[model samples]
Target: MTTNRTVQTAADAALWLAVHRGWHVLPLNYGTKTPLRGCADCRAENTDHTPQTCPCLARGDGALCHGVWAATTDASVISRWAQRWHTSVWAVHLGASGLLAVDLDTRPGPPPRHPLNGLPWPADEPPPVDGLDTYATLAALSGGTVGDTFTTDTPSGGLHLVHEAEPGRWKGSHGKVRDGDDTVRTGLGWQIDIKAYGGYVVLPGSTSKAGLYRRSSTTTTPLWRPDWLADALARTGHDRTATPAKATSAPAPVATGGRSGPRRYAVGALRSACTELAVMEPNSGRNRKLFRSTTRLAGMVAAGWIDRTEVETALAAAAGHAGLPAGEIRYALTSGFNRPLPVPDIRSAA
Candidate 1:
């Protein structure tokens, strides 16, 4: 196993650590957070393919093509990537790895007038200046101090509080809170970003232009995020009530037998599938459900009963809502689309 082998490079070490910790990871551009670009074929505008349908990925080429979607916990894949991008920086896919990263960034400005609505800063004392202080303030308001956990100091003098969580339980969000188009207030206080579902974080032992990401806490095992803190984050950090964005335009519906029977059935099937997927929990085989749903929808697409773009967009949104990351959804969709369509039972529509 790659984890048992002697580390050859910094990338190898990082990959090994990820494997050992059972975290899904992908290679980033050396010394940067950017994901490596796709193969030339994938980048070509003439080729109509997605990360899921890419020939190179299908062949197990270990090509860094689809950004975080290419992340894997598979040891062999990580080994191949480590040997190839020996100097690459590795990033943990927080959602896929069943973790959440609380990022406290450093800022250079006066503190906000009100960081948290109910918890105001003392007028007699100095205000909070950076993320760390803001986080501390939030913690105190939530009825606890910042407890020890798996913490890392970022190159830019920020902190990452790594916590264990079920994947897709929370969505990633920026530090600042917004009400429609206007800024309402700082949610988890200013500069404290929540990195959860649909996000990735640079791992420790990685170096960037600024400096190295070093461990700040002695704790090796990450503590379960405190209930109080989780409650605060749910209230302030995550915008769970917001609706998922829909595609701007959809493909024209394919004509079905010069009638709308098949198209109508397909539309109904898509809606049912999406409704089922949206409410699934992380431990409920959500990925498998997503794959099965995609396969059913793919059969409809292949039969020309519906538009592929519409199916793809709706399924992606549903899977995303269920807490699967964008990459995982694409992978599942690709596999489902490529597989032979199961025998369609149109008796209901008939």
Candidate 2:
């Protein structure tokens, strides 16, 4: 396994790992939500582009804002979503233009011809099923990295190893650019209601070649949009540790914790998964979306959009460490779904 120090080049390895594990790498715009959902006036304005001002609110009288940054990385969000939904992140396709985390472990076959797609592997070299193993896989893949790995615990009784990255100036989502349109959730709006930004853009074969900020991006800080080489370099934040291996575990079960229906598992399952995937507690807008997505996925999984096998794996992977069981999970999902069920005394299973 690669350490955080090499995250700068582990993109390829990350992609390979993701593909093998079953995550669909997609590249949708992260903050493309526009107020266009309903209120035309709510649509984000291009007046200044960046979040410095709220274009979403034509006659705004407050600080400029767009969608809130996602509390978790693309990997964690999808990972949790799959577990709750009884599906696998691998089942979906991830797309992005700059998730560079490839490494020697992740090999490329050929040069990329499309600006949006990733480079191809050598003709003789087929894409690895988690196959590509090289020294530079970190940046080669789209996995983010910092300097090194560290163990951290959350309020929820979950242990995890995560990747950290050099604090390269993270330009807030379309904060400076007045693209007029932003975020996929609201569409053509500013303030993408930062609170609603649920997911991150993950393109499997994309490129970071394009500068970080564009008319489409939410980056606004001088650090993110440095005016000069020094400014850019100076603004770059360092996340020395990237790709820390999470100790993926589950929360301990409580008495009388099981659900009472066929689907009561949704609440516990969602809770367990959330405990494992979350780096920070679900507090701010970004975390709120994570929590919501976790619930949505659990309900979706029970509804059958997810395969049983995938659902089990995701839940186990995230919560396995804590040794949480199906009964507890059942309770969590049941509560999360809060739907009617015929199965009574299910919670008694204990």
- Residue pairs clashing, model 1: none
Model 1 gets an lDDT of 0.69
TM-score of 2: 0.19
TM per prediction: 0.59, 0.19
Per-residue CA lDDT of model 2 for 1-350, tens digit only, reads 22322222223323444545433232222233111122233334645454334344333322113332111125654344323322111111111111212111112233222111112223344333221121123123323222232222211222111222123322212111123422112111111100111223322222232212111213211121112211211111111222234345443432222333434455455555545444342112222233243455555555643434444445444432433233333433333344322322334644
Off by over 4 Å in 1: 1-9, 41-61, 117-119, 122-125, 177-186, 237-350
lDDT of 2: 0.28
What tens-digit string does per-residue lDDT give for candidate 1 at 95-207? 87888888998967655665542233444546777889878877765578778888888878999998988667877766654443122243456677888877888777776
Error of 1 at 58 (Å): 6.1
For model 2, the superposed segments whose C-alpha errors exceed 4 Å read: 1-39, 42-45, 55-162, 166-350
Q: Cα miss at 308, model 1 (Å)? A: 56
Return the top candidate by lDDT: 1
